[model samples]
Target: MAEKKQWHETLHDQFGQYFAVDNVLYHENTDHQDLIIFENAAFGRVMALDGVVQTTERDEFIYHEMMTHVPLLAHGHAKHVLIIGGGDGAMLREVTRHKNVESITMVEIDAGVVSFCRQYLPNHNAGSYDDPRFKLVIDDGVNFVNQTSQTFDVIISDCTDPIGPGESLFTSAFYEGCKRCLNPGGIFVAQNGVCFLQQEEAIDSHRKLSHYF
Candidate 1:
């Protein structure tokens, strides 16, 4: 029998599936969770959180574009934007694409993730972090949303799965805080994973958001 490759992903474990890896590029354990960046022959660079695949360089544009554009385009003339948990900055890159967006403030609990992505997965960020209009706040997204008096035309919470440090972003209180920070008629977008894989989280998020927004 051939030796099996190690797949470091909780989702795979949870679903009883497996992930094939071409190479493991970087790995580390943060105070929060384990971070791993690797390459697959098909996916290029892949970033995983606590062993779960978060973003892959190959299909990231599709995700970031849809997540950032739909709400902003529909809202139509947003100036200020607030992003929570997008420590990788891909969402920030897409948000700045709108010429009407004059400012962007991103709140991320893990600064180390930002630095890691900046250095290794540079393609995701596209220089957005260095943009003068973009401001990166290294703090808990939940607290920032609840505490910031500044209102925004759009709020995008590009968070990880609803577990570990990201669990708070999925709650009713967080939704209320997001609503509190929104300008009149402003919109909020959150990337909830596929319902088939995260049924409870998806339904629960919808329920909480409906209650607040």
Candidate 2:
């Protein structure tokens, strides 16, 4: 009879040496996409939804930095910020870069994502989860903006791609709500889908945004 393989041996065979470089979470799937969650020494914990790498815990800073800083610097000063759909708190970390920022409201539809990040994605949050300057609301982004009368100096939509649960975020109604939620001089920005693969949608979205703003 063949001897049983050791746990490490089995893992190495399953994921290969590259996959074992640094792992935070790991699970295999026979019916659906193979889920592999790992921490890159530089990028942090990353979730692979369907064998495709999702958000990483570490390098998220690069995206958040570029997304938040360019606008803030161009605007010269920003005191209030609103983030939509950044459940991982990465954007919030970047938005707080301005010391003058008095308040940051984060609207995330799924609190589970946030909770998971708090537990396993420390590199992204950096313990900002409990910061008094930050207010987290687990609610629909559209509804939150619709009900909110307070305006913001900058509104950043850090949502996922326009599929799955984030479809409403890219709708005309959503943009209307965003316009209403922004201060007179407020700037609104969102990370649209890939420019190469989603050119038409991108163009349409820009046209819609132009109409609203």
Relative to the unseen true structure, what is the C-alpha lDDT of residue 147 in candidate 1, on a scale of 0 to 100? 96
Segments in model 2 whose C-alpha atoms lie over 4 Å from true places = 1-36, 40-44, 48-53
Clashing pairs in 1: 9-51
Against the true structure, what is each candidate's TM-score?
0.94, 0.80
Q: Which stretches of candidate 1 lie over 4 Å from their true place?
A: 1-4, 12-17
Flag clash pairs in model 2.
43-58, 44-58
| C-alpha-based local distance difference test score of model 2 | 0.73
Which 10 consecutive residues of model 1 have the lowest summed lDDT? 10-19
Q: What is the lDDT of candidate 1?
A: 0.87
lDDT tens digits, residue span 24-100, model 1: 87889876878888887778899988767889899999999999899999999999999998887799999988988
* Number of the predicted model whose lDDT against the real structure is largest: 1
